[model samples]
Target: KGCTWRTVSVDKIVTRDCHSKVFGDIVQATQPPACLDACGSQKTNTSSSCWVDCFYKAAAGPDSGKPGGKVAGMSFAELTAAWEHPFLPEDQGGCPPVKPKPPWFAHTTSVEQKM
Candidate 1:
């Protein structure tokens, strides 16, 4: 007896507002806030999810991608497009600010300006 496949529910998916062209997948992340330096609204586990999903899809190839990148078959362009939403609402404080921070440094910076 053995598990067949790894099943990640759609609900678990954290959609990021940003997109990446290099990688064909959503960019949702959950490392921490850069501005707040203490949880600026990043979804939990989204970063891991994004990483796994991206790797899986990449290894699967761009021509055989699924989900938003589906075109009856995965395409490089589609994969990249699918990765449009990388940050979930929780991951980010709603729409990304004029300037967004990387997941790892999302909530670890001080917003207060030094005089």
Candidate 2:
């Protein structure tokens, strides 16, 4: 017996239109990089423009100029050095603040007390 495979796509479907209730499990099933889990999302203006600018800046700073960037030229030693250096703001000290514990029967002496 012969076998054949066919590809199919739905034109109108998109992430925005996909309801959480319908695709919540599917969305949750996705496994992002471990680093993403460790590092929460950061806000940025002009996302696409920032990506291009970031690539350029990382190449050799602003003076490197437009179309002057080379991504592959970077060596592993340089990359490793950057990875070891702190990426977070100096004020944060590279660590998120500790969250206070929730009130519970054992932990809570008075839930009624308004802080």
- Which candidate number would show the highest TM-score if scored against the true structure? 2
Tens-place lDDT per residue, model 2, 9-95, is 322222322222222222222323342233334212223454334433443444456475444423557544443323233353222
Task: Provide the global lDDT of candidate 1 against the true structure.
Answer: 0.39
* Model 1 segments more than 4 A misplaced: 1-55, 58-73, 83-97, 100-115
Worst 10 residues of 2 by lDDT: 20-29
> lDDT winner among the candidates?
1
lDDT of 1 by residue, 1-115 (tens): 8859874633333323333322332322221233122223432333555444444434454344555554233455655545543433535433242343356855565567422
Q: List the residue pairs that clash in candidate 2.
A: none
Which stretches of candidate 2 lie above 4 Å from their native place? Answer: 1-46, 53-71, 87-115
| C-alpha RMSD between model 2 and the true structure | 20.5
